[model samples]
Target: MKRSSFFSVSLAIAGAAALAVAVTAPASAATPSAATPDTSGVYSVHPIVEKAGLSTSAVTPSLTPAQCLAQTAGRVACQTPDSIRAAYDIPATINGVPAGTGQTVVIVDAFGSPTVQSDLAAFSGAFGLPTPNLTVYYPGGKPTWTGKKTQTGWAEETSLDVQWAHAVAPGANIALVVAANDRGATIDNAIKYAVDNKLGNVLSMSFGEADNLIKSPNANNGQTAQGVKALAQGAAQGMSLFASSGDSGSDNGAGFANYAFPASDLNVTSVGGTNLWAGSGLNQPRETVWGDFANCPLTCAFGVVGETGGAPSLFTSKQGSDVAYNASVYTGVLTYLGFLGGANNGLYFFGGTSAGSPQWAALTADTIQAVGHTVGNVGQQAQSWASKGLLYDVTVGSNTTPTFSGGYSATAGWDRPTGWGTPDVNGIIAALK
Candidate 1:
C-alpha cells in the first residue's frame, strides 16, 4: 500500500521507537519495513505485510491463536487453515468429494517467488491439504532476481497468495501469473494476458495504488484504465475478479477520501480487512474493522499503524470494499516462505487486504465447484447474500487513522470499512446452489 508524505513521517517516528525495542531482542529479528516491501508506485504496487519478519529456524507447521499470543508475548494472534475454515464454516468436502475440485484459481503478482513451489508443497504437507496442480506462467518473460528488495518483497507476496489460496480450496488447480515488472503497462498487460488466455474462473490481484495517484494525468498514464478494461473483458468471459482495497485506510494517507484503484474499479470485487477474533474452540468468531491506531497490541509494539483502505472512490461512485476478510496484523494469518534465504526462511504472520484477495479467490473456486458453473460477479452475489444473512455484518469500528481523520466507519449494512463483513462460507455455498 502507498503512503502520503505526512503518513510517512508518522511511521518513521513510530518506527524509530520500534527499532529501540528490537535492539534488545535477537539480532536476526527484522523490522516491519525490512520484512515487508513498500512498492508504492503510482502505477505499480506491492504486497501488504502488516507485521515484521518473525521466521523460525525450522517449519513450525501451524500455530494456534493462543500459541501465537504466547510466542509473541501477547503481541499477536495467529490462525491456521483449520481455524479459518471453522470460523468461516468452510467445508473440506462437498458431496463427499473434496471441495473446489475441477476449478482453477489464477493469482497474478509481479516478480514471482523463486521457491514458491517448494514452499507451497511444504505448507500443504504441514497442513494436510491436497497438493494443488500448480503452474507458473510468465507472459512478459521470466524476471531476473538479484535478491533486491523489489523482487524479494514481491516474492513474499507470491508465497502468501499461492499458499493461502490453496489452503481455502485445496482441490483447485492454481496458476501463478508473473508480470515482468511493476511497471504500469507490464502489470496491466499481464492481466490482459490472463484474460486473453482464459486462465481460470477467478482472478486475484493483491496490489493497487492510491486512487488519487491513478487519476493523476502525470502519474497514471491510463494504467488503471487499461486494467479496468482487462478486468471487464475477463468478467464478460465469466470470470470473477478480486483485488485488495488497500492497507492505508480510506484516505490512503492523502488526508482525504482517497481509495485504491483496481479495487475501486466496478468490474472487480474489492476486498477489505478485518480484525478476526476466533479459535480456542469458540463456536462463533467475532470481527471488527482493521484499523489500528497507536493503541493496538502487536502492531503498536512494532509501530505499525494499519487500516483497511475504504470509502467512496475519487473516480467513480463505487464503494472501495464490497466484502472483507481477516487482515489485522494483531490477528494475522500464518504463511511460510523459505526462498528469502538465510535466517529469513520459515513461518511468518502476515496481515493486510492483500491477504484477503487470494483467499477470496479461493472462495470463488469453491463457489464455482458448488454451483457447477462460474459465479459471474462475486460482489453482486455477495451483495444479494447480505440480506439472507450469508455474511457477518460488522457494525463496529472505523478505519480512521492519525493521518486521515475522516476515514469511514463500518456501518449496519454496506459502508466503507468492511463492506458486507467477513464471509460465512458454508452459508454462501448453500445460497449459490
Candidate 2:
C-alpha cells in the first residue's frame, strides 16, 4: 500500500510527561547599513511567529543568558561552552522527559569543525547555554573532507546542530559523528557507528543530497544502506533520529517529498520545514513563516520572498515528518562569520530547517525525560500530534515551486509542507508517560 500522505495517520502515548523550561552573535569589518542594525548576532533576531507556519512560536525573542540558563536548567546542552550562543537559550537541565540525564544524542554531519569547541562555546556563551554533555569525535577520529567547497558550509551546519541540541537538552550527552565526505557511504557509516555504540538516545542529521530518501540507493550504496539500517537499528534500540528535510523546498531534485538520504530512509524521521512564528497568543502576533520562492515562470529569480510553505514528497512513507518546527529565514539566527577561515569569517547569518532539526531532537530529550523513555518508532510517536493540543496547528503558507503539484497552498489542515504542524513542547511533555 502506497500511503499518499501523513495527514490522517494517528498514534498514542502511554503516559504522563512534561518538559523543563529551556532555552547566539557577532561582528564584521563590513559596511555601513541603511537598516537599523546589521543583525549579525544570535540574540538580535526576534522570536519567530512560525517557521513556514509549522509552529506558532519558534524563536524566544531576546533573553538574557541568565534567563535562558535558568529556564532550561540541566538541559543546557551545548557543543561548545561559548558565551555568545548561550544567551539565546539552553535549558539548565533536560529534566522533563523520562530518559533522565546521561542520555546521549548523536549529531551526524558531512564534515568536521576543528573549531567546533570554540565556536560552540561562543554560541553557548552568547545564548547562556550550559556546557554540553561532551564527547565528540570525527568518525575514525579524523574525517577526510578533502577540503571541498561544501565542507565549510557543512561545518557551520554541524556546529549549529550540536550547539543547539545541547542547548535544548543540556543534561543529555552529545556524540558528534562525522564522515570523510558528503557524497556517500562514509556519512552513512558514521550513522551506523552511533547506533552500534549506543552513543545516544537521539540522532540528528543535517546533511543530504536531495534525493528520494527511501527509494533510492543514492550514489554510495553499501555504505548508504549500512547507514539507513543503522538508523533503523538505532530506532529499534530506543533512539529517535531527526533528519533535516532540505532547505530547497519541493523544487529540490525532482520536487515534492524529495527527501535526502537518511531523511527518506523511511525508517527514520524525515523532518520538513515550516514558516515559524511567535508572539503572545495569536491575532496580530509577531510572526515569520517559512518561504522560499524558486526561480520560475512569473518569477525569474528564486528568493525568500514567496515560498512561505515548503517542499513536499509523495514518495515519503506515511507520517514521514512526525512533526515540524521552525526552519526558515526572516526569523534567522544572527552571528559573525568574520571573513572566511571557518568561524573567524567576518560575519554570518544562518537559518533553514537545519536549525529546527536539533531543536526538535533536544525537545524530544525533554519529552523522554517527562515520558521516562526515549522515543522510538518516530512515525508512531509523531502521530501523537493528532491527539490534539500536541501541536500548534499551522494554518498558513505554501511552497512556491516552479512546477508545484496539487494546489500546494497552505491551509488550516495538514498539507505537504508543514506536516502535522509544529510541536507543542509543553503539551507533548504533558502527554508523555
Candidate 3:
C-alpha cells in the first residue's frame, strides 16, 4: 500500500512581554552587560498543545501538511522519521551502505530526563527503527527534578534531541550529556566534558540565550570564555557542533532583532526553521523559510507579530542560520514525550529550531559515515556543498516581526533567516565524498 494513500485520511486530525531599562550612568561607570535571563539564560522550548485536550491513547503518527493544518478536529500532525527522510530525499540505505554504523552523535541539554531511555525505546518501537546505543552522562551530577520548571523543560528538550537524532541516523550511537542545572556555567561544563571525553563527532545543542542578552551589563564573562573554549576544543577534536537559532524570531521577546547565542558563535552550524510540505508519494517536496506572519492576525497567540529568528551578530561574521527545517508549530514534527504531566503515553507535536538542530546533527552523522571519517569542519563543509547546489535553497518568506525591522528575508542565496537553506542528504554525501 502506498503510504500516500493514507496521507489524506491521516490529515483530518491535526492540529511574551518585556520591560525597558534606563541608562543614566557615565561611560566608565556603565554597568557591564549581564546575560538576559529570559533570552540568554535558558533556551526557549515551544510545545504546542492541541486546543481540545491532551490524550494518552494516541500513538505517534505521521501527518501531511493538509491534515496537520486543518482547523476542525485539529489532530496533532507532525512529520515522522520516514516522512522527513522522504521529504529530504535521503536514501533508505546509502548504496546498501551502513552509514553512521559506528559513528556517535552527542546531545547536550540541561537537567536530564528520567524517562529518556524508556521514552526512546517506545519511539523507536513505534517506528520500527533500531534501538540506539544510548548513554546518558551527567558531568555536574544527576539532576534532581524537584518539579522545577527548568528541569521539566530540559527533560522535554532532551527527549526531542535524542529521538530526532536517532530518527535521522538510525545507525549512529548517541551520547546524551545533561547538566545538573540550567546555569550558563553548568551547561558549559557539560559541553566541555563532552569534548574532553571525545563523546561523539557531531553534537546537537538545542538550548541557547539571546546574544544581546548575554552581552548585557550582568553577563558573566567567565561563562562566555568557557563556552568559547569548549567550542574550540570540540572542533579540535573533529566534532561538529550544531545549535538552534531560536524560536522567537528576530525580536526574541526584546522587541528588536536579537540573535541567539552559541548559534551566533562561529564554531557552530546555526540551524534555523522552515515550513515543509511533503508532496505525495514520489512527488517532490516544497519548503519556505519558516514564517507565520500572514496567519497570525486572528488565530495566532502573539497576533501577527511572530516569526522565525534571524539578525546581525556581535560575535562572528556568520550572522544567521546555516540551514533550516520544519520549526513552526503549524508545521511541526512528531515526537514522544510521555514524561510530562498531563501527557499520556502518546505522541506530541513540537516545533522550533530545537527540532531543527538535532535532525541536522543526525544527518551530519550520515555524512560522516558516508565519508568513512569525520569532517574536520562540518560548518565549512556545509557551505562548500551549498555552493555546489547540494542543498535546497529557500527563496520565499521572511522572519519579520511587527516591531523589528532588522530581520532578514529569504532570497536567492544565503540569507540571515536560512543561510544556505535546507539539506539534500544525497547531494551532501556526494559532495563530502
Candidate 4:
C-alpha cells in the first residue's frame, strides 16, 4: 500500500476508534483546502496520525520538552531534537566544524501546507532551537484545495518534513517545493524545478507510489519515468535525494508483493523505519526493525499489524531500503501542525517513513557541512558506509503478514525491513569526512 492511501484505509477501519476520542473541531475552524488527487495511486503523502484517546474539546496545551517526556506513560512518546541528537549520537559539532550552516535541504510534498512557516516557528520555539531559514515554492502551480482529506493529510506531511529536517540540522536552510497536485507530471515538474534552480543540495520526499503500478501492463502510464530522469539529473549535479520506503509492510494494498516507486528507484536513497527505544534523557539503548503490531495505536492508527516496508524490488536494480530511522509513532517525534486547525493544533505525534526521510535529509545536510561538499548519490554513499561497518545493523524483526503473500525479515546484513539498518551519524560523518 502506498503510505497516504494506507493511512486513509487504516483511518476508515479505525474511524470508530478515532471518533471515540478525536478532538472536536472549533466553530471557527478553517475550512481545509481542496484535497490532492491520487492520480498515480502511488503518490500519497506519508503521515500516520494517531487519533486514539485524544481530547474532543480542546487542543493539547503546549508542553515543555521535559513535560512532553513526562507524559510518555502508556501514551504516545514525543521526541525532541535533543533526544534525537542524543539517540543517533549526532555530535553538537562535527570534526571541529558546525553542522549545515549554509547548506539547504529541499522538501518535496503535494498540496503545500498553508501554515508551515508558523508551524515550524512553534516547533522551534518549543524545542528552544534557533529559527531556520525557510522558503516555500510552488513549481507547477499553487495547489487547488477541494477541501478533501488529501489536502489535510499533505498539510500534516509538510509540517512533519519541514520541522524534522530543521530539527536534525538546525542551521540548514530549507526550501519546501510543493507540487500543484499529486499527479506524476506535477510532482516531477516540482522536482525538476528545484534541481534546475539549485534550490537545495538535499531533497526529501515523504511520499511514494507502488512500483507494481508502473510495471508491466501499466507501463505506459509514464508516472515514474519523468521523475526518474529528474532524480538522476539531481544526483549527477551533487544533490542527494531521500525518500521513504513506505508504510505498508510488503503488500501493495492490492494484495500483492511490491515496493514503492521513487524510493524503489535506484537514484534515490530509500529510508526505512525502526523501533527505537531510548533510556532516560533520550539515550538510545535499543533499536530494531520497526515492525510493532501489538502497539498499533501508538505507532499506527490502522488496525493492529503495521510494519516497516521491506522487500526485494520488483521494479528497480538495487534493494528496497538503504537506511532506517525512529519512525514508530509509539516513540515518534513531536511536531507542530497549525494547519490542522481547531483542537488538532499544537504538538502532534507522527510516525511512518514519512517522518524518517526528512530526518535523513537533514542528516545528509549535516554530512555535507562536515565534508565541505555535497555527497552526491546518497544511496551509493550508504553502500560505502555499510562496507566500512559504520551502520547499526538490525538483526531482528520481520515485515511479514499473513495477509501478504511475500515479505522479508531483518537479518544479519542488508535485509528488507531495515536495509543497512540505521546510520551511526558520528561514524557516518567521520567516515565521509
Best candidate according to TM-score:
1
- What is the clash count of model 4? 7
How do the residues 1-433 of candidate 3 rate in per-residue lDDT, one tens digit apiece? 0000001111112210111111121222111122344433544444332222223233234534444334322322347777888778665565464446778889998887888998888888877678778999988988777746556667767888999888888888999998888788889899999999989889988877776656532245777678888998998888889988876666665666678778888889888887775532213237776766523311333222234677777656767888787776545666776665552445655667788888888888888888787876556666677789888888877877545656678898888888788888988787767
Per-residue C-alpha lDDT of model 2 across residues 1-433, encoded as one tens digit per residue:
0000111101111211111331111121111112221111110001111111101122232532233223323221111222222322233444543232666767877666666776666555554556655667666557654545555566666666776676667667778887766545667677778888877777887655544333334434455556657776887788887776555445442434343545566766656565433421224222223544522111111123223223434344542344566554333443322113632332123456666677777777767776677767554565466556566556565554554443244455555556666666656666665
Number of backbone collisions per candidate: 0, 108, 20, 7
Model 1, which residues run further than 4 Å from truth?
Answer: 3-63, 216-220, 280-285
* Cand. 1 TM to true fold: 0.86
Model 4 lowest lDDT segment of ten: 8-17
- Candidates arranged by TM-score, highest first: 1, 4, 3, 2
Q: After aligning candidate 1 to the native by TM-score, how far in Å is the CA of 271 from where it should be?
A: 0.3
Candidate 2: where is the Cα deviation over 4 Å? 1-100, 144-148, 212-223, 253-257, 280-289, 294-320, 334-347, 403-407
> Which is the winner by TM-score between candidate 2 and candidate 4?
4
Of 1 and 3, the candidate ranking higher by lDDT: 1
- CA lDDT, every prediction? 0.74, 0.49, 0.68, 0.70
Once fitted onto the true fold, the runs of candidate 3 whose alpha carbons sit more than 4 angstroms away are: 1-77, 95-99, 216-220, 280-285, 294-306, 341-343
Question: Candidate 3, residue 167: CA error in Å?
Answer: 0.5
Steric clash pairs (candidate 4): 24-56, 33-147, 34-145, 34-146, 34-147, 35-146, 42-209
